[model samples]
Target: MKLTIVSRNPKSTKFPVTLELAGTASTIKTSDVNKALAAKFPKYYPDRQRLTTEDKKVLDLDKTLEEQGINEQSSIYFKDLGAQIGWRTVFMIEYAGPILIHPIFYYLSKFIYGSSFTHSPMQTVTYYMVMAHFFKRELETVFVHRFSHGTMPFRNVFKNSAHYWLLSGANLAFWVYGPWFAQGRAAAVRNDVWIYGSVAVWAWAELSNLITHITLRNLRPPGTRVRAIPYGYGFDLVSCPNYFFEFLAWTVVCFLTTSWSAFLFNIVATGQMYVWAVKKHKNYKKEFKDYPRNRTSMFPFIA
Candidate 1:
């Protein structure tokens, strides 16, 4: 096969270089081809390369050349995907923002909500919940979750961090503990009942979310890019049990706090999670013939 590598910088190489394969096209995996290219070029590592056809159809690294309809005479274009960041690092950065930002807003409430505003007991409870939620996420990022894709584009760290930092941290904390919300806490008896009841539900959601993450981590062993149908525990209820529980937790927060910011964040997160769940559910059906027929995405039968 003659492979062509398109440089991001025009001055880098002498244009696309032709490579001759040493083995039968049917036997060579797309990943093996990237290894050979990396060997000759030393710059385009397999993980950093985004291979595509002449017509711009992206190639799957997991499949063989024969499966992709490529032969000895076919030409493929290699695009260099800039700097990469570890998935763990991206997750850590994203979760860390919420942990720090939530506390900052809580402590600086006098400045943000003015000197007249008095802190409510519910505010203290909310502060603790926000801290615990992000801290647990940080712990999971470090030890529990196992990612199939080791790295992603480095630029994605900013985007991912912004979501957690802006919505879950700043928006959630600012409104829930603000003076406007303190006025609503006037119904102290009713508020206490809702807050305490929701705390129990939130605790259950958080624990279930952790369990689903562990189940997913076990599905793919370390150092392998294998995928399997997830079963048992929360998986029996929804395709993305983690998402369902996460949504449940946030929904509980929104109801307990009665804050528009919390409700907005929950809505945005649910929309994003539903999109991801739908994609994952579709992929499971496509990849595994034995995938559960009755399994929906994040929701039960309604989705």
Candidate 2:
């Protein structure tokens, strides 16, 4: 059987190949065709896993060519999956998850649970702070951050959405909002010093995080993947100042709300950020000879 392999790019040349179908009853799989394409055009399809498409729609790579209704003389186009969902889409979805999810639970506590503003003003402040943090993240995703790759796996969007949305709902609803309603205005306002101090810290951390992100974004030109040793701001003290500031922001929220849910969320989030920062710091040291040796992974003087 003869099949035509087409490149998605119109300028690129196409080729025809013959497959032997006389031997057995088994159908020819996409993997078999991919191997044949690699052998014939090694430069074109260096990674055969990326060689797939349905000109009319999307092709399932797991299916046999015959099972997919692909017959002799059928043209299967080659496409790169990375082009489907770009980096902007990934960041937008990730940042939007928390922004959308947090507000729903926050408002629901007020309207559905009858936790009005007079009951606790501190709850209002906490609600606004959470919204502000996620809103800033969404703005940063659009304007401040520079992504190295054009796209990520499509499934990652769902995974990331679930992580942020579920966590935000649990943290904000139970700890930040629900407790204030249950305890009333007196209990909420009892910790005047702690509440005010945490709010101040949260504000400072949020500002510092934004500055660090902007500094990092300005380091490289648009569409370029150049990585430079970050300096100034909090970078002089820590390799991942952004992560450190983020940890501080959440820690302050935990203190202000006095919620175990908030505390546990902070612990888990900070641990993950620390691990990522450590790996990134090692990569920076390995990649750049002049990368600072004094800077810790996330903290100023400690890991």
Best by lDDT: 1
Q: Write the per-residue lDDT of candidate 1 for residues 203-238, one digit (tens) a residue.
A: 999999999999998988897788999998878867
Q: What TM-score against the true fold does each predicted structure earn?
A: 0.90, 0.70
Question: Mind giving the per-residue lDDT tens digits that candidate 2 earns over 191-232?
Answer: 677767778999999999999999999998997778798899
Worst 10 residues of 2 by lDDT: 16-25
RMSD of each: 2.5, 11.3
Error of 1 at 6 (Å): 5.6
Model 2, residue 31: distance off in Å is: 24
* Most accurate candidate by TM-score: 1
* Residue 218 lDDT in candidate 1: 93
| Minimal lDDT window, size 10, model 1 | 181-190
